[model samples]
Target: MHLEETETMHRKITDGVYYVGVDDHHTALFENLWPLPFGVSYNSYLVVDDKIAVIDTVKNIFTQEWLDNIREIVDPEKIDYIVLNHMEPDHTGALPKIAELAKNATIVFTQKAAGMEESFYNVGLKTKVVEDLEELSLGKKTLKFVHVQFVHWPETMATYLAEDEVLFSCDAFGSFGALNGKHFDDEIDMRMIESESKRYLSTIITSYFKFVQRAIEKVKGLGVGIKFIAPSHGPIYRKDPTWVIDHFDKWSSPELDKHVTIIFGSMYGYNLRLAHTLKKELVELGVEVKIHNISYSTMDNVITDAVRAGVIVLGTPTYDAFPFPKIWAFVNEMEGKRFQKRPIALFGTHGWGGGGVRKLKKYLEENKFEILEPNVRCRATPTEEERQAIKTLAKNIAEIVK
Candidate 1:
């Protein structure tokens, strides 16, 4: 009801439902989910009934408040199950503390989640492994587990309540904004929630669209009413479950447009000028082009463009005879994710030996990318001749897309 109340963690949703979305002050590298915007909340839920069940737990830093929230509803010892829908640290960081609180409760998760629990926490606790479509009865309500692997992690899952038609969707169908004394989906501005939700999904869950689509299809087939979708982040999707599900459907489809993304790091502004010239030439040739400065652009945004673009062009000014650090890191991350089957080109302005283009080309080749022939590279500054060469290369990129 009050924003200050949510500061200490509050509860909402149905009469039997409660939530403890703990504030996480992670910064730069840790706090942001996937894309690293430096703010987020690790949501945990307490489903009160004849046999109480805690849907998920928060990060270790918020364990005390997490327990206090549980204590407010019912004694921790009375909790019958701790349903683990995901094993990521933000969601499972307080497993040890939660295990201590719910001493008699069994940790309900998929077999993969059970295996991951050992890696997450060193605590010894009893775990009850469930497979796809496995149902666990909790007095009047029954929770069904559906394995949703590779949405982000192999151990991820979603829990459904048969009687209430509520879905405990962990990490799926979630947003980034912290709750402001409102827990249900309908209470928040749908436009703001949808925008944040799209950003979060595009940054974190873009790569695993196939698996996410499969999970969505499986859930749809269950014929559950799905009146509410209580994800483990942001606001709960109680008002419009279909809104999030439809978003996943559209994002996961392979019907995106053709475009070119040029990511580069320029120290002296010469390389940036070349990138801009190339973008202009490409657009003149009737190609949609998006350019990003590696130092300022987020890799998540790059990845999102990469998924929809037909070509990826990397430009970098040589730094100690190698590509720029951000450019190198970007390539390494994309390579590790096995991002392939796209045409790639390299361009750069180097002062001395001009090694950046060669090094980037080798890296893209090793990463199994279809290297476009005759990449554009300029030494020091581009002359009119070199500018013409870049324009030609842009045309080549457009031709490849066509």
Candidate 2:
């Protein structure tokens, strides 16, 4: 590997590879669902050899910026192959523009992505469908494709540069944060990256966790040394690539942390008081607890904590004879994500009617969550007996987690 002074615009990965990705700071939400408090990045790579190849393209909105980044390295028309690792718009929205400019470039992707290419852009240009473990020689550099289906999408695959030992993992190891000129993992605050990565995993890829585990095992089975992991989002893992890999393995595994997450929707502070009381009991019992008010907290954060915790507790005030709207919405979201089953405790308050706790209990049980004993329900405020029941509920949860 050779070192060169970093250019003001693009940074070099090694002698021939370059980072041509773009940062997105304007989009307030990721996929129009998850909040983007730290923004996000769309990473693309350019491999310069005897035959130049562009790994991926950024979102259409950042076409000019992406083009300018590549133009600084080589003429767009000189690109020999445009590798489509994933068909998601965030990574392929600029494909049509690049294909138009690079008239001679042939689109290279897996057999599955070939059909998606036409559906997405229909550029009608030349294309090459490669098989898994197939290698494409670009003079001095050799690129190998590994099929890792359903890392989040069935058509997803990762490219490996044997010479440089860099894995161009599309979304398999991605996070939700912009590089902001800090492209390497060691250059930024990793604590923030780990948290955001967990949130990303829970929101985007948790449903396909089994696939994630298989992908990780397959990549490891390849027995290739990985010098860097360049994903389509967030920073490149150069310092400790295994850190991200191991974290993904653990997050996808069915193991839970010894902690509790309490999510509540309180109307007029009745259920809110119950949530606090439960928290106090759990804390005095030496069990860690995370409390979230669904009314204001984003679903992304709540899900992140919920996925990590060993025990889950819900408190909602009855609304229209059902669980509170926000709490009900959260439960639906968790159901879609298909989180690992854990012990759950339910508590709620009602005025004239009392069906909220019952409905919640049934739904949670149907979803495979083990219901803890003493499912507490009360009137507008908790009575002395209900308070005792809440404490008992907390004790049972702590015992299970411990």
Best by TM-score: 2
lDDT of 2 by residue, 164-194 (tens): 9999998988999888888899999999899
Q: What is the overall TM-score of model 1 with all chains considered together?
A: 0.89
Candidate 2 runs further than 4 Å off:
1-8
Cα TM-score per model: 0.89, 0.96
Give the distance in Å from residue 12's predicted Cα in candidate 1 to where it truly belongs. Answer: 2.3
lDDT of 1 by residue, 34-64 (tens): 5545356678887777888888888778878
RMSD of each: 2.7, 2.3
Q: How high is the lDDT of residue 70 in model 1?
A: 71
Candidate 2 has its poorest 10 consecutive residues by lDDT at 1-10
